[model samples]
Target: MFAALPAGASGSFGLHPQDGPHVDVRIAITDDQVTLSLTMNLVFLDELIPQRREQADLIDPPESSQTIAALLEYFASEQPLLVDGEIVEPRIEALYIDDPSPELMPLFPRTGMRGLRKIRFELIYPLSSPPDRVQFTWNSYPMSELTGGPLVIKAELTAEGILDIVEFTEQERGYTWHRTGQDIQSRMLQVPEPVVQQEDSSLLSTISIIVMAVGAIVLIAMLVSGRPAEALATLILMVILVPLFYLVGRPGNTPPTKEEARTIFDSLHANVYRSFDYVDESDIYDALSLSVDDELLEQMYATIFRGLIMQEEGGAVSRVTRLTPLNFDLENVGMLSRPTGPGLPEREALGFNVLYTWQVEGTVTHWGHSHSRTNNYTARYGVIATEQGWRISQMQPLEQDRVDDDPEFTLDEDIEL
Candidate 1:
């Protein structure tokens, strides 16, 4: 008995079963069409179309046409592709069954597996012009009885020279691709400028000097005229005026509290990672200027950009998705010397050195695949108050370790559609 899975079908099981059925969805968009391909193992195919289970010849079955028709009908009804907010039907381009590769054999093991063949469907949805937006909703999931859990679909999309990956589950079944000339997941951190307290002592100093000079002349004249009482009164007035001027002329430069320092450093550190979101070097540098010192901006950008590149993925840049500060210690706080202006003498300001440990979750998508990694890093950062605000002055990496690495494939690299 062959029955098509209902729309938005999902399993009631808790977790995904190990070595269970999986689906790979690849989507590529060109000027006039959107190409979509789905690949699944034989067990999953049999679960979808039961007639395949009874077939003697899996590769060149006599009922291959019927099986393909059933698949096409099922997808046409269950999976709806939207282009520019309009529902578009996908026409089947090709369907075939091939032997599973040695590397993929582990994914679909021989033990308890119905067959070693893998089924693939290449489909195309026509577009009048380049679409501004495209969305796909996956509604078919393997039954709990067949896979013991809900299906996991690794979906990869390539459009406008940008590649992105989205994992689709029962909970997250829809993926939308936009033609905007920007990384969808990338964003700049909004770090507020540092507040600086301004001080001007020239007025008070001038007033004090005038008062002192007048008092000195009066006292000297009074003493010269042998008027000691008047001279003593003048001296007392001068003493009071000088102290008042000194108190008023001093600037109130209070250092940040420990909690405040943590907040400041947190924003600065996060902005450093967010700076890579921009595509242009000048844009990245502009973003970095918000949190990093000008002296360290270029060097920091180079170092961090190099670190973000995944060499295994052919030098693909990873986008940071999440950042978590595990441990933050305000090691010390002291004066930071900075140049007042060009050709001006350097002055000291409030600064702090911090030792912190954090973890970054980054994703690298390349060639229709997505690789995710979580890295734990411990580093020392020097944050100082500047005219712009508080900025990261120095960064010294202490330790870095890759905590997790997960690579997901939407299609086999060797298999060309």
Candidate 2:
């Protein structure tokens, strides 16, 4: 979606009002509830706001909160959604405006799609079961009431753990999904009528955005697994962003392939380090449970990461570990036991052995001063495939060693890394 705003309208704080009209809808559904996210290009909103402001008095300026709030109100009322044949009110969880340049630039089909303003909104609705049918209208207010007869729109919907994806124009509004006996069916309700619109131009743009979003969510996983090379490659492609957690890493779905198993493990492992690295001990157990069962969850907590968190003697202590090294030697890190053979099928478990060597600098009370130490670890992890993807079901240390090279410092305490 390419659009350009008039001169002096890009706002000092990075708001770019563009000329194109695009709406991106992302929907995630579970057994009990549905979460939807909408991203609307501000070009159409810029045109529609004047009509609304003239009709009412709330809208003051293009980038003001009042204008956004007013627009959100109209969007909520006009949003067409149904749950079990009844109209459902989606509760607004967040509403805001952003500059899409930083995100859209890295996307392919850049198509000079820069300097555009985006209105991002999230809505959550409770549902007893998955809706059998959907009546989705992209932008009713702009299409019905704006100065333009019908603005161009690009709508995208992704249902979590479901293979069906909906990406079409405003004309294709109705959709259906149902399951009978053992089969599930999903299809658009009617054939879309042809319109004089721009050809679908954002295929690469959509893919790039999804990849960027997924990378942002799971980058930490790659980091904790001693895979900084992979994480760094992704970081160079685009600025790191934290999208809504629900969009990526379908946590409840099984990983049918080895690559997926590795991805899930990376997410789980990185989250474990994040909890400990940030000193949030309470979250370690929950993070570990993503890849492991209860038995291993309790075991790792009691035997490994928890043991490291309790090493402080007294007084104030500070530790800093630098993860991003410019000249990192990837060969130093090794995977000892990878679960990549027929054994995994018979045992229903995957195992991994990863070796890491790193350094830390900090001050401890017993030392009464500052010191540096080099740490080395050879760790093995095991995960079992379950109904809800793969989980870490086992953890054990294959080897552990550390080196303190300061002659003045006596290293007597056990360190956790």
Candidate 3:
């Protein structure tokens, strides 16, 4: 596709001859650029002969024969007349320059009249560039008295040297081979083998640089990923970030019957996760925002969080993980969890798994901690509706800190295990 064609352009090479001469010029406009042709007829003329007449013998008896002969001899010694000029020439007519634009004629010193004896001309066009139309007119005068024949002329012009444009590179050459202005996959340029060979070592250096860059990116990703909440908080701290997120987040949930379960899920992903493990305070709220009750949901959220964190006796090293889900399909809601990080011995024969699903009956906790006590977490949560939205509420935990005090209670409904 060509870029865009300009409106109402003259592409035909043409000539509109005037009485004195004929001027024909051809030009075209493509993609707002100009192209010109080789042949340009700028001037013209005509030649003719008249019938001879004999002088009467008694016209007063022309000048003496010797006198006339002497006069002709005298004229012969002088310059020979071609009759092209005013000697045998008729009155000079008018002059014209074809198309005129850019005010060039007024400003250019060479743009002016060319007068020779009987004719006068107006140079309407000066030194104009492409996009300017060229035009000219011939003089209509026919004077037979002075010269026996009319004038005839031939002229030519060149355009190649006038345009001096560059040759497009291979990649850019698509501008020619393909339709311009259309959406298409950009073609890749082929590099010469000689150039490739010259850059072989440099290519290795570039690859090394790229590898290092990717490594740094991954390291940064890991560092930031480990603290999803902190990253979110920092982003929210920006002047416009929170508003931008809110705009993106709020649009889908326009209530007059807002269904936002998917939105709830998106929010969680946007605000939670330090990776596969660990929950930060912002993640806690991200989950809390899904709560349906103002009071009960707030209570549940506060319970899972505490300024006074559980401290290991003797500052012992133990892992702590707390999580709250924001979006879940109750039908697909089931839990399968296992120890995944440090302190779970790599070669330890015993591993831990747990099933906390509501879908199927007979599902049971897989294993318990070595201690006799275990925790049943059902009392800690319920679903409710509030002015803000649906939320998890009324979580009742048996204890806050120790694995030892939690009860090994089972569901009383007893459909199965």
Candidate 4:
């Protein structure tokens, strides 16, 4: 169902199957620790609940010590919290069982059928100050399959609006958040495999090394066989090969040019929309840093993540398509000197503008229903040279016009599951 809302506990389940239980996780981060709140479906827990008979047994905990430990272990391993690259172990703090309200039951499928139980858990993990990068994996059922089907997970961060809400299905299972500002800077994560393979190739050096070894063996063989003429010719070839190999092996540094700046802006612009299209908030922030400065990164985060929170609440998801940059300009600002490193002199600063007209398709959905509209977006971007190359310093949205009226979708109260 196309429901609109931050994959919050309620709206998240509306998108998944009602016959099964889903897991909802909320994470809140403080300076020193991360708090995780997990809500599990009671219907789903039916299998895990131990059979009982006595009145005292009913008063006893519904879950056994082993069951609790196993669940905790599953949770800990499924979505490991990594500060930098180190995994942090979390301590379980609290657990409780409750029932969803009648009004809220409509937001979740099958909750009222056999009655629903909400199992809540609180866990805390220590963290470093200003972590380098925070990473998590989302796999609801990593160990064993349950009766209904695969588990659906909805995740959110209540760290004072620091993180965007996240949803995970069986298909998408990982999320990464990069640190920015407050002396916290992050380079792009390792280049994607395809991109890395395409750029800064190392094939030439490999070939050169192989040839050098072969040439040495050939020269030695010729000399041992009393073929001085061939050995001498081989020696000449080796000397010539030395300079050729050195030149080929030298790393090439392409200075930032206006054309390159434009390309960077276009890529960054496309990436921003692509992240939203895929419902990847972490990627949005990471890609933002590639072209935009920290201030603009934060602004974009607020606009893209915070603004969409309420919409997500209704179980609505947005997917962008066909983002076209119609026009752009890369203007050069005067060169300004900045220190490169210790004892190094300042170098010229490259500055520019990346202005363009963008056309895009926006698809939003709620409760299995969808609405799509075409939008024409015009904006100007300010790009400046940094140690990392050209990055966007500012972003100004000039205008946004809906190219078409949204398609209508009627939601029947008795919509089929």
Query: Top lDDT: which candidate number?
Result: 1
Q: Could you arrange the candidates by TM-score from highest to lowest?
A: 1, 4, 2, 3
- Tell me how many residue pairs clash in candidate 2: 4
Model 1 stretches astray by more than 4 angstroms: 1-20, 26-77, 89-135, 143-147, 154-167, 175-186, 200-255, 275-289, 294-322, 334-350, 361-375, 385-389, 401-417
lDDT of 1 at 183: 40
What's the best-to-worst order under lDDT? 1, 4, 2, 3
Please, what are the lDDT tens digits per residue for candidate 1 over residues 303-387? Answer: 7887788776566678776777778899988887653447878767688889988777778743223567777788888888876
Better of 2 and 4 by TM-score: 4
lDDT of 4 by residue, 239-341 (tens): 8987787775665334355666656666666555544432346655666666556656777666555323334335344455355565666655444343245
Q: Which lDDT values do the candidates have, in the order given?
A: 0.68, 0.44, 0.26, 0.55
Error of 2 at 299 (Å): 30
Candidate 1 colliding pairs: 194-389
Cα-lDDT of candidate 1: 0.68
Task: State how far residue 111 of model 1 sits from its true place (Å).
Answer: 8.2
User: What does the lDDT read for residue 238 in candidate 2?
Assistant: 57
Please give, for residues 294-341, the per-residue lDDT of candidate 3 as tens digits.
Answer: 344345445433312222222211122222221233222212122124
Output the better candidate (1/2) by lDDT.
1
Candidates' TM-scores? Answer: 0.55, 0.32, 0.18, 0.42
Candidate 2 stretches with Cα past 4 Å from truth are 1-18, 47-73, 99-115, 128-130, 139-152, 168-170, 179-417
- Writing each residue's lDDT as its tens digit, candidate 2 over 1-417 gives 122333333242233223344454556656676677665554445544544343221222453555645655665676656766777766667665553343544332322332255555677777877666555544443442223545434333334332223433357545644432221111111111112223333664576578777878778788988899898877865553324322342233222344444444454544443333323344445445544566555666665443343243322323333221111112211122323345454243333332322233432211001223444444556655454444555565655445445353333322323
| Candidate 4 local distance difference test against the native | 0.55
